[model samples]
Target: MSLPPWISEQLPENGRVNTKLTQRHVVETMYQSDRPFFSLQQIQQRLKPDVSKVTVRNRLDDLEDRGIVATDPLADSLTLYYIDHPESEWPLSPAGERALNRESAETGNPFREFLQHPLVNRVFREELLRSIAWAAIGLFGWAILVSSSGQLPATIWTVVGLPILTWASLTVGTIGVRLMTGNNLRVQSTEGLDTISLGGVVLGGFWAVFLIVVLDWSPLVTSGLYLFVTATYLVFYKRVIRPRFDASVED
Candidate 1:
């Protein structure tokens, strides 16, 4: 029931009292709400008549920065925010600390810290941006192949089929891991390396040889298609698989 420590700083008798009160109300609403998450518009609506849209957004941003809240960002839906441990006395709980550390790592370059904006940081970390990048590569690669070869290459199957197979295999592996361990599958290096990606590499190597020799496909085309397949797999994983996986984990 106490104001979050970060927002509880003593303010002199001034206009700052309103700011402190607004911050208290924002955190209280998030902590007391039964719903697990809320969108910006939803939070603003709940605080109707007292808080303006800009004021609500500003407080939410402040709360996030101080590690009092977390976000559930979806590619297809509005990014939602929530309080993970409203009962904790400390504003930055263990989970909140981890989130803060991850955000700091993502927005690196000591000199650019002053120049970094919250909106820019959020956009860069968004799965939607990554999805768009993969889609652009696929579209441009197909266009180039068509323009150079005067038609769609028959080897397109090698590109499309491999990604479909790899993605499906990864999805199955992810489900198995989650079912057994109740954790999201994570990519690691060396001894802790992700098995699914490792398997994909070995399989792709064999498939590449077959495509180049047995099917008479050019080495360049085979390699290019392999890259396309990787992109395709990422597009599917980031936009589809990841969002669902995260949602399930949260639930």
Candidate 2:
């Protein structure tokens, strides 16, 4: 396959010419594909049979380091790679421009562009909204239970608090991971966040039990208070935090 002239121009002319050529081939293949993401094995299989998996892996790592590609943090076992933005990263040759224009014309989906915008890319805005919906459903169920029984069940707090707690933990854990990694917006692995979130759930459950048994607080009051806190947090996320992220992308 003929590579774009721009890609050939970027290749090194040193002793590592063959290696760079191979890497260029890998990149050109990724750039030409319609798929947004590809696993190591998939790329290797698509290319010449002689191309080794190690070669493909190394090339992908190099591309990612150069900000030409991005990977999914949630993907486990097999790492996925996708072009970040070829138009911005590389000076596109005429052929490359034609290919991109053709792909855009074929797809003809304006909404996809909005979804790919940096403001919406890294942040879990949709996930946050979904979590709120789940918590609301849980809250509705809790209310019905309280009305029918006239008292909170011992396990009612667990059911009512779990969604909000999970969402809270995920939000806090994501921020904590970003801070710890010094990325401030993105983290390499979500394992730390997941661990923190699980711990929060356990601690939250215990705290709810403590409030019920030791303080003699009504479960209704405790549950209402938890829901109230969650509502406040949701408002803050939508009004304050989300706008900041959106503004950052705009800038």
Best model per lDDT: 2
lDDT of each: 0.57, 0.59
Error of 2 at 154 (Å): 99
| Candidate maximizing TM-score | 2
In angstroms, the error of model 2 at 44 is 0.4
- Give candidate 1's whole-model lDDT: 0.57
For model 2, residues 1-251, the per-residue Cα lDDT tens digits are 44433344344322221242355677788877766678888888888888778777877777677666667654568676776655645444446667886786578666775455443343456446545755665565455445445356546465557546755776656645643453434312334434554575566566566667755679998877766765676577668865654444331
TM per candidate? 0.29, 0.31
Q: What lDDT does candidate 1 reach at residue 49?
A: 71
Model 2: runs farther than 4 Å from truth?
Answer: 1-11, 14-21, 86-251
lDDT of 1 by residue, 46-137 (tens): 77576677788887777777666677787575777877454444344445645765666587765475235432233334433344545555
Model 2 accuracy (lDDT, Cα)? 0.59
Error of 2 at 215 (Å): 99
Clashing pairs in 2: none
